[model samples]
Target: MIEIVEKGVTNLELSKHLIKRLNYTQWKRINRFEFAQIF
Candidate 1:
C-alpha cells in the first residue's frame, strides 16, 4: 500500500514538471508571433 502511494506522488510530480515545460515553450512561441507582427 505504501508503494502505491509513493508511485502516485511520483506521477504527480512528473506531470507538474511536464506542464511547466510545456507552458514555457508555449510562452516563447507566443512572444515570437507577437514580435513578428510588430515588424
Candidate 2:
C-alpha cells in the first residue's frame, strides 16, 4: 500500500494524486476509518 500522505501540492490536486494511488480495497479501508472517526 502507498502512504496516505505525499509530498505534493496542497489542494484538490493533491487529493487527485492520492486517490489515483489507492486501489478499491484501500479506498474501502480508508472510508471505513473515516466513518469510524465520525462516530
RMSD of each: 13.1, 6.2
Each prediction's whole-model lDDT (CA): 0.54, 0.54
* TM-score of every candidate relative to the true structure: 0.34, 0.35
Candidate 2, residues 1-39, lDDT tens digits: the string is 134334544545544555688786776676655644543
Q: Which ranges in model 2 have alpha carbons more than 4 Å from their true place?
A: 1-8, 28-39
Assess candidate 2 and give its lDDT. Answer: 0.54
lDDT for each residue of candidate 1 in 1-39, tens digit (9 for 90 to 100): 356446665644544554576776764565545544543
Clashes (backbone N, CA, C under 3 Å), per candidate, total: 0, 0
- Weakest 10 consecutive residues, lDDT, candidate 1? 30-39
Q: Please list all clashing residue pairs in model 1, or write none if there are none.
A: none
